[model samples]
Target: MKTQDIFVLGLTTFALFLGAGNLIFPPAMGLDAGTSLTSAMAGFLITAVGLPAFTIIVLGRIGNTNNLTKALPKWLGTTFWVLLFTAIGPAFGMPRAVTVAYEMGIQPFFTNDHLVAFSIIFSAVTLFLAFKPGNLVTYIGKIMTPALIILLCGLGLAAFLSPLGTPAAPSGDYQVGAVTSGLIQGYMTMDAIAAVGFGWVIIHAIKAKGVTTQQGIASTSIKVALIYAALMASCYIVMGYVGATSTSIAEHGVNGSVILTRYVAGEFGHYGQWLLAAIILMACLTTTVGLTNACAEYYQDTFKASFGFTATVIVVLTGVIANFGLNDILKVSLPAILVLCPVAIALVLASLAASTFTVSRLTHSAVLITATLFGTIDAINILGKMPKDLGDFFSDTLPLYNAHAGWLLPSLFMLITTAMIGRTASAEKKFGRVDYRLKTANND
Candidate 1:
């Protein structure tokens, strides 16, 4: 595609990936990172922007959505995709999107009844926009995304010009390993998992633009990745800086959202609240539309269900779940996100390198299984208590457990070991066949 085409595609991709957490997390990181803003944002960008961009490239190579499932064993693939869709769609993602819109956009001005009413209206609009898959890029990229960016730019500029204060002392997790904490926090965004869901949306959009063939897809994906990385990294840096300098509000605010709301109100006076609300709603709505469409497409393809049926199911289920509100949804969904993120990251990285390495089915299975097990333990540790001794043992023995990257080493070792074994087996089989052919020729 041309420059304009790639630019629009980038806009669409950016809209799809930026959910409530993307909006909320960075500033909080900045608040904690304080003086370490540069290192922390750099680290955050790796997992948050870099990993997701890489996942998009991997999906482009595979060409279409179902091919992601081909990376693992058949049943496992199906199960993973199903669970993934749930995690990023109705169960946690969609409802969270709805709540973010309501909380940030509407809550201060309205009552609980009004929030519920707005959610229904929000779900209806999402379902309406979701029905026409081809229009997703046009709706989000051409229309909603521009408005969102303009709003963010205004807010970012205002914050940048008026200094909040010098960044306070590094606090909590940022005090020790700010970069590592930022890395893990970036991982927690779970955008890689969302990318898996959003990949097909991107491919379809590219196809709609008349770009076919693996080479074209790969090229376009590269362009999209560059745009996504640049755009997201810039936003994160600004937001993190804003958070770092928010020492005055830091006493009153515990999270990025709180800090942002206060800053906007302070900066723009009465109008800031309305501007912030609009920005939050736009951010949440775009993500909702993208996710609903992606999940609907997946279900239609896999279960042989109609698109209308699937989309309706997703929207309705999501609407009902949203009533549980944001905190509860996060509580239930955080564990799943923690466990699946490592698995998703591992899958994308392994698949991208599969052509260069002697990657076996065993390698896929072993690495995923190992990562899942460790990730589950990590997830459980988040919600409730693990045995003190066991937790201590793992935290001390594992290389990066304290960094929330305990799964990395185990997954890497399994991938290498299984690949080597598979390569050796293939070599031995080839030699045996050659020897048998020689023996047959001698007898002749």
Candidate 2:
């Protein structure tokens, strides 16, 4: 690909990742972290930026998310894929984008009564844009993303030049283990899962730009991931700073959207609110379009449905779900995300290891199964559904249980144990060992 083409593709990928949670979470985290913002932001970037970028690179090498599960049993692999796409598609992600755009972008200035109407309009636009997947790169990269970035840059610049207030004292979880708190907060963005779901879209875009070979695709994906990570990290830092300084304008523990609106209003009055609205709308709309396109394509391929029909169904579903409101949507999404993210991480890491080592189907199954089991526990704990005794036991016994990452150690243990066992079996076969009965008979 040409230098210009790579930049455009990178911009498109960046826009796709920059959506509802991406905009809101950073600032909310920063507000809580206050003086501890640096350490907290560091932790946030690891999962928010690093993991998503890593996922894209891995997907490039593996072809698509389907390849991540090709080694697993057919039923299990298909189940994983379907659940992942559903979570990040109309079920949670796409609808969340619509709600965020409305609440943050439209509701603050206008009447809060228009969410359903706004959702209908938003879904229509998303459907129209998603109707042609091929045009996403042109639509988002060349047009919408640039405008969104410029508006954001202006807000960031103002926040830096004219401060809102000095950073407030750290609050709540930010007062202790702020980094870990930030890490868990980053998990809520769900961008890593988006990367997996968006794999086919990115791959097709790269192919469309004349990069056909596996090596070419991998190389280009690395470049694009780097660009996407850089853009996201930069925005997060700026937004975090804006949040940290807005203590004078908004109370600590307020919604991130509230913090942002107050900051923009303080800085540039009514016009600034308009600018912020435009920023939120563009950010959410681009994401909705990208997600709808990707999800529609996946359905079309998997079920042999027409693209138009799938796209229309997804849009209608997203619109209806958006009316459930942002808070309710988030309440439902958090548990789902907690359950899905660890398994997705395991898949990404397992795929990377497979590229370099002789990973067996058994090893893959062990790692993913361990992740799923522990991830369910984490989700139950988060929902307060786990028994108090069981939750306390896991919290005290598990390494990162309190940090919402209890799955990591168990998953790693399974990976190593299964891998070593597979290695031993391979070595036994290589050394010309026959069946145990034959060897015993010969010795007798």
Per-model TM-score, in order, reads 0.95, 0.94
Clashes of each: 0, 0
Q: Taking the tens digit of each residue's C-alpha lDDT, what string does model 2 give over 227-320?
A: 9999999999999999999889888779988888888999999898898889999999998898888888887867798999998998999999
Top lDDT model: 2
The lDDT of model 1 is 0.84
Local error of candidate 1 at residue 166 (angstroms):
2.1
lDDT of 1 by residue, 342-375 (tens): 8887777667656466666676777789889988
Best by TM-score: 1
lDDT of the candidates, in the order given:
0.84, 0.86
